[model samples]
Target: MAEYEALIIGLEMLVELGIQYVEILGDSMHVLKQIAGEYKCLSLSLAVYPVAARNLLTEFREATWEHIPREENFAANELAQVATSIQMPEDCVQRIIKIGKKSLPSILTTGMEIDVNSAAITEDDWRNPIMTYL
Candidate 1:
């Protein structure tokens, strides 16, 4: 479930960036296979993630998913661990941002829609939400 959530988040970021091509690499064969339609998502809790991922894939002109060894996926794994564990100092100048777990997929969230056809974004564009989230 964590893998799927990460995959969906990555895909959403790519879409917001207007990237037409993408190659996704992960260590989870089960998640990749389910996204590729080679395996069934039998768990009701996990079913929405693959569907959301597949829908995001359609936004790209070309997209591919590859499974790498766990050792090769160390960088992303380490990043995830750091993101979850890091604490901000109270006296720091920068404002502390908190992200809460979502009960629904990001696509179902409202107020941050990107225009896929519009290649250029102005300073006050709708991309503000994504930019802020990032």
Candidate 2:
């Protein structure tokens, strides 16, 4: 049920992003097969998912579904684990924060000390204060 919900949510996000073509991949063979029309979703509680997912696929000019082995889909598995671990309010909107890779090594290992009282700093200068706090 959670797998199907995730697929529906992902397709909705793609539509919101104005994506016209998409290749959907999932580790759940049952869900993928059901969505692909190769198998029927017999459970009353889960029947809505395949219908919702297929409806979402209509919004795209081209769409394809594929089932991959769970071992090959580590990223999705990790994301599902994270999603299940988080607890949020019903009214709260989810936000995705994009973080860039650090170009410099750790300050602790580099034996660098920060002078927090320095006046020659701009609003964008976050590293110094963060390092000092750490």
Question: Please, what is the TM-score per model?
Answer: 0.61, 0.58
The segments of candidate 1 whose C-alpha lies over 4 angstroms from its true place after superposition are 78-134
- Residue 87 shift from truth in candidate 2, angstroms: 20
Off-target runs (Cα >4 Å) in candidate 2 are: 77-134
Q: Model 2, residue 125: displacement in angstroms? A: 72
CA-only RMSD, every prediction: 16.3, 23.6
Judging by TM-score against the true structure, name the best candidate. Answer: 1
**Local accuracy of candidate 2 as per-residue lDDT tens digits, 1-134:** 77876776677678978999999888899998998899987665566667777877899999988888988998786886996787676897986654334222222232434333334546578766875688
Clashing pairs in 1: none
- In Å, residue 104's CA in model 2 sits off its true spot by 41
lDDT string, candidate 1, 1-134, tens digits: 77877788778778978999999898999989988999977665566677778888999999998999988888786887998888778788896575656555565562334333334657788987796789
Listed per model in order, the count of residue pairs whose N, CA or C atoms clash below 3 Å is 0, 0
